[model samples]
Target: MSGNRAAIRYAKAILQEANEANAGDIVFDDMRSVQATIRGSKELRVMLKSPVIKAEDKRQALLSIFGDQSKYTHSLINVLVGNKRIDMLSGVTESYISLYNEAKGIKEAIVTTAVALSSELEVQVLEKVKEITGSTNVTLKNDVDASIIGGFILRVGDLQYNASIANKLGNIKREFSKSL
Candidate 1:
């Protein structure tokens, strides 16, 4: 069907196979490596997506690349290739990552500041987030935006906490316009 749907199906298939083989962690690592390989090599991606390439040839290539590392992963790649779903490789890998994260209860947080945060500040922010979300674990990605002037913005999942000076100023400006 659709690329995303196919990708989700393949991801589930891979996860199920991994679980059955009692190598779920190993398969996850292998999937990460596979995703990196596809992202790093344009030629490899082209080969994987090429309609002219035979399924057997694709399977051989995938086996050569990942067999020693992870036989289960190799088989998963082969199945995708055989089904003419190689183009969904990236999406599949992403879906697998999402699934893995959900299984692990890992939360991703994005924190943006006008200036680079010191280690102490970072720790403080992380601790505050943990307290607020009651999340035992947090993956914090940091970004610096000079346009923000000062303060920070924290985004955890679908929720955003914007304390940036730019946002505050914009809000004040809106209030002034309304009053006028």
Candidate 2:
């Protein structure tokens, strides 16, 4: 919980600072790159969590990877490293994205299905979701999950509509047990 709070705090601070400097959009892109890099690299994740490594070394490594970032992002890195909170950088980036999306009135959604969605189905899902949510700026992301067996689950913010086959099976199983 403390980690989440810290990430939110950092995100809010960065959002405010970047907006004041008229670089909110640029920093948003930078945050996306930062999040993508950290999420895709197992080595970087391991290195960030390793306590034996010096903070300065980690800071240098991050700067090199994200050297194209604006001065605002560089300052953010310095602040995190100085406070020994570099491991929370990814969380901070994600939180900042959420905040940015909110500021822009954009809604983000994740749809998990048994198989990859066809482009047509993806458009249909987005239309249905936007209609249901009454949101004009909805962004839908598709995630394939074979474990769900069939159907799809849609999640928008904290609200989830679970129409997946796995959930239905669990409900049926519960009913059968109750009958027994």
Q: Report the number of the highest-lDDT candidate.
A: 2
Which residue pairs come into collision in candidate 1? none
How many clashes does each candidate structure show, in the order listed? 0, 0
Candidate 2 residues 1-180, lDDT tens each? 113989999999999999999999999999989988898899999988999999999999989988999998999999999999999999999899999998999998889999999999999999998998998799887888899999999999888999999999999999999999
Query: What's the residue-level lDDT of 166 in candidate 1?
Result: 98
- In order, the Cα lDDT scores of the candidates are 0.81, 0.92
Q: Runs in model 2 with CA error above 4 Å?
A: 1-3, 144-146
* Candidate 1: tens digits of C-alpha lDDT, residues 41-138: 99988987888988788878878877666877767777787777767777888678666666778776779999889999888888988889999888
The window of 10 residues in a row where model 1 has the poorest summed lDDT is 1-10
TM-score of each: 0.64, 0.87
In model 2, pairs of residues that clash are: none
Q: How far is candidate 1 from the true structure (C-alpha RMSD, Å)?
A: 5.4
